[model samples]
Target: MAKYLVEASYLSKGINGLMKEGGTRRREAVDELFASLGGRVEAFYFVLGDRDVIVIGELPDNTSAAALALKVNASGVTTCKTTVLLTPQEIDNAVMKSGTYRPPGFDEPYEVENWEGEGGHLAED
Candidate 1:
């Protein structure tokens, strides 16, 4: 299974619905949605930011992730961004590989930061 980070921002209609149903009910609804898709919701958080909610879960693959995103987006309630999440071992494997290719005009100072993998946070690119 692949993990995904789904950042969801509620549209006005969705927010109105959420306001009536409240957080717990909203979370349960999401859980049901994932379950229907044969996925499990690992974590769900309602936060004040550019995104209204952040969800982390494991799905079968990228297709499952994209399908979930498109279905939710089509609902006219929320827009979502889905990103694949990699574990530390996965990153270490990537870092071990040799690469020399850089994007066009990609000269810039790189900043190094450590990720603790707390909540749904993944390593930054």
Candidate 2:
């Protein structure tokens, strides 16, 4: 399963619903929604900021995550931002792979190297 961080800001209608249904109900609703997609919520919180709610959860894959985001955005009650979370081991595995990319206006592709180094800073060439 892949993990995700979902930040949501409630619209006026959503806030009104929350006021009527209460926080617990809202969390339960989120649980149900995630269950329907074969995912589970790891954490849920309401905070004062640009976003009203934050959720950490896991889904089967990126497609499942995207589906959840699309459904929530379509509800018209809230806007959501979804981020794919990677583990330390995943990053290590990625760093071991080799790849190359050409910069804009450049003719040759530069070899990409593992950037991990002391103090977590990129290694000097």
RMSD of each: 7.5, 3.0
Question: How many angstroms is residue 74 displaced in model 2 relative to the true structure, after the best TM-score fit?
Answer: 0.7
CA shift at 53, candidate 1, in angstroms? 0.6
Write down the lDDT that model 2 would get. Answer: 0.91
lDDT of 2 by residue, 1-125 (tens): 99999999999999999999999999999999999999999999999989999999999999999999999999999999999999999999998987776657656665554346455533444
Top-scoring candidate (lDDT): 2
Candidate 1 — what's its lDDT?
A: 0.86
Give the CA lDDT, 0 to 100, for residue 99 in model 2: 74
Q: What Cα-based lDDT does every candidate model obtain? A: 0.86, 0.91
**Which 10 consecutive residues of model 1 have the lowest summed lDDT?**
108-117
Local lDDT at 71 for model 1: 92
Residue-level lDDT of model 1, residues 10-100, one tens digit each, is 9999999999999999999989888878899999999897999999998988888888998999999999999999999999999787655
Q: Estimate each model's TM-score.
A: 0.76, 0.86
TM-score of 1: 0.76
